[model samples]
Target: MILNQSVIVDIKDIIDKAKDKAIRLVDHQRTIMYWHIGKRIFEEEQEGKDRADYGNYLTKFIAEQLEPEYGSGFSKRQVELIRQFYRTFPIANTVYSQLSWSQYKLLIRLDNQDKRDFYVAETIKNNWTVRQLERQIHSNLWERLLMSNERESVLAIARNEKHMSDAKEIIKDPIYLEFLGLHREASYYEKDMEQAIITHLHDFLLELGNGFAFIARQKRLHIEGDEFFIDLVFYNRLLRCFVIVEIKTTKLTHQDIGQLQMYVNYYDRYEKKDFENPTIGILLCAEKNNAVVKISLPENNKTIIASEYKLYLPTEQQLIAEMKKEIEKHDYEMELPTS
Candidate 1:
């Protein structure tokens, strides 16, 4: 009674298709179920306008009743989450399938409507997983936008565009490298950190922001029999240029700036296409002497940059203090009389 070989193959294909369709159907159904639950909770809470204390007790009681009947999916905490979800996104049509409940929770916590909209748009545009969304949230992507000259422009692009145009557009200055899990005070060599970044390249790229693809590590360049090795090389499709990153474990110096400048020059002359933009060089260090950086680079310098990297996320107060210092410096410089 066994089927022939061709019949078996056909049957297997049909089964596979059926299973795929079933899984998709199940996902759709689950999404609908959650939306409905959220809606019901919202309506009930509105109806019991005077019963402020009753809401909590009612959710717990409902959870107790539903858990046994509907399995563990209806836990009290989850019910509360569902209620919050409804309150957050009243418009069911805006509930994207790509986002999970956890991501929604984070979005709801964002007080600024513009900031929340930017994250939601980016989340959908990038097809970011919940974990990626969480990482970006933790990295203070919204706050970083506030530092940009074109804050509104960037938000508009993020909201309306399908993909970013360049890595530079998305990359934050002084990128937070806290995910590296290195100690701030401990002595570490530049090569050691470079190696670590290469080893954990995926996570590093994620933290580097969007549109970056690793080209090589310790990419060798030959010029008239002299050999030079670039620490790390990447191509940013959005920027349409090669990005050269040099790591320094200590404070930045004029020498670091000069070295990066040379790398940018080399890439532009030998590596970059005629239509491509000039190669961009980044000098990443533990600390930077801003005066030294400004003096070392040409007044019209656009290809090279020096930025600090942190081994740990700064505390809220620390971030605020740093921001305040930057603002004060700007104000003081502005108020000073010109020579």
Candidate 2:
């Protein structure tokens, strides 16, 4: 993927497109082979209606004959799995090329269509590897997201149908930083954590959710005679805005919120173009006081968000405890009387 000189960029683009198409062609052919095998098995079953309801027996018989010639992949169970694959994804064109057979195997096993579609769409949209997809499924990503948001939001994200309107739509709180391999107990400087995140930037971006494109790190800001650096800068394609992030390995304070707000204002006025939306500032911290966050921002504030990040994934009980705390906060907010 070497970049050619500006004048010859088209050659590189052409080759890349060709390579992508070749891969797609191979994927399509392999998918077609499986579908054809499933179709043959199904058609054979249809003709055996007059025979004893020995479809399983016949399957074994077929496997016996084919296993010798076609190898172990033709085992009765593998044949059934192939048949199930075709049954699950009946339409050939609807089968996505972005997913490999391994991914499809995972998809086909899920009996629920909505759940299956969610994973399929997310895998394609996120460019998730088979292992990543497996992890997401195991983590119950859909269920966890649904805990915080409306079902529509979960569905929209899974279907790639959601249009992000604000920072909250695209930004995730308590983002997993396990990919950094940092120990939560270890005391490390902010630079060490930031550098680790930068090193695993791609995974961090995926955990951040969709549409975030990294711009710069420690982006310098000059205001009056003072110079300050924001921890991270990214442009969100979906929100059409610059997002400035500040990292704190301590619980967030009111002063921290104010600092991030200042950074957001700086980017909005100095860096953002007139066509771009207002810049968003996210304070990623070890912990945050949600009440402090609510009071620090103006009513109807959309630009500044305080989110917690975790170095290690919490256990299911721990996650439940956290969600319960959030729900309690929301309940408290609803209980407050309006002026």
Candidate 3:
């Protein structure tokens, strides 16, 4: 009699689970190892009582002794990093296993304690990987916080006690669109730019920072018997609000602001749930007349933002020049005696 054969073991599932468990175990061990290394280095440096020279010599000696045995991972730079890691985070208990060594390296480089703490909390809260953390840091998330709100207010939000209350709280001015790979001086139609953004949606969202999820592209709406299509729509889970993005290939006009405002109003009144906050409208234009934008909006306007989009990232010199011009303008205005 011929017996029918069937497989009893699910090898693929078993292997997958084993791989996941192994990864977790490795990460846990690495975390504990780093913490111990940091602690030991810190103690040795302290005992020497000459921190600067001691730190330098310690790293060199450790590198020389460990490199031959352990491989390139024990280089002088890495030893220095371990020393810094200890110095930056003195409490070993606070070391997070979920955070990779690369993430810690980034955090320890930040000189400001509050900024480091904010990043750490946000990374943990959002479950951000090292790449996401790196991107957020490169995008100047700390500078954005400073520009978005008062120091105390931002600190409160950073501490997770409060949510961003307005569009200005979350929107970055001069939204970087360099990933679209368009030339700054080259003229392009609005539709062309919109299509590029659609094609590179993932990169665009990464540049847009965290908590944003794309809702629709070219979303249609009807009002007063006229149909209008929004360029892009996003929902920010953290802020609990709809974000309407409008693209302009030319300099911004008052009409553009008005159009975006209409979109924001529509989303706030119709699309948003009762529990959700007011919708935010962002006008991403090639250029903006800040004076016109200031005058076009209401005195208490907080829902609409007119931000210039740059096809290329600004050079250091360009940013410095712009900052100097702003300072000069402010100083000039201050010097002009009040009527």
Candidate 4:
């Protein structure tokens, strides 16, 4: 006999809850077991502190005793990592039930405490899966974001406690689009870039930073007898404002800035609610002239920003060089006298 629609909905809810509870239960038990293993290893090390390679030998012996019965999960390397995990997070009270063993394994590998703390907090706040966490770590998301702000700001973002009073908080300069698989030497059309971004919208939104939700793509506007098409549009819940993004494959120009300014003005006047903050506009191009941007906007401008986008991920050295240039430009802009 077929069930009614209401019965089917109830059955789905039951299945979802059961699946979630199973995952939580398994993760909690696994985490506690690993922590206990770590504690045991630590106590042994303390008792035989004089032995130089005692810890290694002890872990190997423990693995040999357990692996034959319990399998590879109790291997020497795994046990060592568990020992490090326990050392790093000494207090059992600090462990949360939501994190799985996979997350803890990655957290244990992070050498810097502050960076480790940031990743832990961000992983929980964002509800990132192991795969997402790995990608963020590989991309050096923390360092890339920290490159734009002071140390305190990084903590605020990781904690999801940031109060964004300006557009700068959400705007990342030299945005990385390495996942697009586009080559730096090859030129592409604006629409091509737009299509690629849409195809990888999930990664794009993550790269765009937190609180961004897609609104429209190539949004059209009809005013009087004229027509206009905006390349991309997004809404940032944290900013409580509409964000307009325009893509350019070539170097930025004063005219490009002017066009973006018009779009921002339109969004603020037409799209945004009375209680919302002012709209923000971003010009994403292959190259941007700071001089042109400075000259194009009004003196008190805070709503429009122009930033470059990289087609590929930069090396550590390349990231440093790029960040240095941006910092120098910001300093130069600051030192200029007011008109």
Candidate 5:
């Protein structure tokens, strides 16, 4: 007897899910096995005073025996990594079951415990793939977050210890768009960049931070018989607000901020519900003067943000310089007297 099409489809889905679960289980077991191996090596070293020689000898002997039975997985380098993994996470419970051995390998290399903890929390929260986690690490995402927020606040958000109330906590400056596949040297229009962003909206959302959902593009608004078009629009679930983005390919001017401010005001007044937070306006420009941005908006303005965008990934030195500039700006703001 022939089965119904729906039944066949359901069976296929079940089989696929089962296979995925099995793969995950095997991966978790492999990670646990490596941790146990590392623990045994550590235990062996406890009896010897010279840990250096003891570790070397232990790994070498293990590799000599295990390589004959297993394969390259039991090589001396692999054994050393396993030992380091155990050393990094001494407690078995700290080894997250959701993460694969490859992800753990990357986490073990980080010397800073806070940074490692942040990544662990984010990896679990976002369900990020190993490649995505590696990319975030390479992009210096943690350092970028620290540029605008305190270390503890950033970690708190990542760990779900605190709710995200401000966009500044998640929004990054000099937003990286290398995944858009646009050449830095090539001259492009704002529309072109917007199109590129929509084309790779998934990666853009990853770069935009968590809880962002794309809404509309070139959203039309008629105010007093005048037509205005918002370049891009988004809603941030965490912030509970509508996000208006205006793309400017050239250096930002005061007029750009005024236009964006108008859009934000329009959204807050007309588009937003009473329960929703104030709409946020973001000027995504190629270059922006911080002083100009500050002077254009009110001192207490929290709805408008001027963020620079880069077509390429920034170097470590560049990110450091950016962080220094942000700190200096923050200090300057702090020194100003309140009215």
Candidate 6:
């Protein structure tokens, strides 16, 4: 018998969906089994709670008995982690079915409850792969965001507890582009960096944050017979605005900020719809002077932002230094006398 092309396509789709469902079912069952094992271990430890090492003893004992029969996954370290997983999420129903064992393993390692919660919400909302979640953690995404926002506010947005009111909620400063394969010692042109971003557009978008869609590259604009080209243009659905990114391979100058301000102004006046929010302009540069940037923009300016781009993720020490520098700057600004 012969089948129509549409029928064959539909059949293939059904088979694919069935396979996905079966995999998910198996994963869910495995997660439940681990939770049950953890629960039993916790209950057994309760009897000897008075002893300081009883919990460790119980887990090690359980692992020794189970590993030989069930394989390496039930080893001592694995058993201890599973028990900690149960401690982290006591209620079995709170365990996210959408996440896999590998993803949970990463989440369970986070010491901060708020940080862990933020990643869990982001993973579920974004459908992030285990590798993606791992990258975000290693990159210090939570700490980077915390630099600009309050802890509760950041957590609220991640948890979908509040609507995002500002672009900073999603825009990150000192964005990492190690995936671009650019060496710190190597000199690259603006076009070269722009091309690299285009080549790894998927990773770029993930780094850009949620709700951003690429609109154009080398977006041309004509004003009174003069022509200008924007290095990149993107639209953010959540912000309901156009995002213009100007690439600078060196330290930013006031002139660069002025040029970006013009692009933002032009887009706001000509391209943006009546119902849309004001266009936002970002200067993605290798370095920027905070004083120069502040003086370049108007006091009330919220549409233009200067964000530094790093070729690699900052180490823990470097991030701490940056945080301290930001805190000192904020304190200095707060001390300035009002007019």
Give the Cα lDDT of each candidate. Answer: 0.80, 0.83, 0.81, 0.86, 0.92, 0.91
* Maximum-lDDT candidate: 5
What pairs collide in candidate 5? none
> Mind giving the per-residue lDDT tens digits that candidate 3 earns over 178-227?
77889877878888998999999987876675679999989999898999
Steric clash count of candidate 1:
1
Kindly indicate the candidate among 4 and 5 with the higher TM-score. Answer: 5
Q: How many steric clashes between backbone atoms does each model show?
A: 1, 0, 0, 0, 0, 0
In model 5, what lDDT does residue 133 have?
94
Query: Model 4 off-target regions past 4 Å?
Result: 1-6, 323-339
Q: Residue 160 error for model 4, in Å?
A: 3.8
lDDT winner between 1 and 2, please give it: 2
lDDT of 5 at 325: 84
Extract clashing residue pairs from model 4.
Answer: none
How far does residue 122 in candidate 5 sit from its true spot (Å)? 0.7
Report the C-alpha lDDT of model 2 over 254-321, residue by residue, as the tens digit: 99998999998888778899889999998989988887899999989989988888877678788788
Model 4 Cα lDDT, one tens digit per residue, 35-87: 99899899999999998999989999999999899999888888888888899
- Our model 5 lands, by Cα RMSD against the true structure, at 2.0
lDDT of 6 by residue, 1-339 (tens): 776799889999999999988987888788788888889888988888999999988988988999999999999999998898888878878788899888888998999999999999999989999889999999889988988889999899888898886888888997999889999999889999999999999999999988899999999999999999999999999889999999999999999999999999899999999999999999999999988999988898788889999999888899999999889988998999999
Q: The CA-based lDDT of model 4 is what? A: 0.86
The Cα error of candidate 1 at residue 1, in Å, is: 24
Q: TM-score for candidate 6, please give it.
A: 0.95
Measured with C-alpha atoms, the lDDT of residue 145 in candidate 4 is: 70
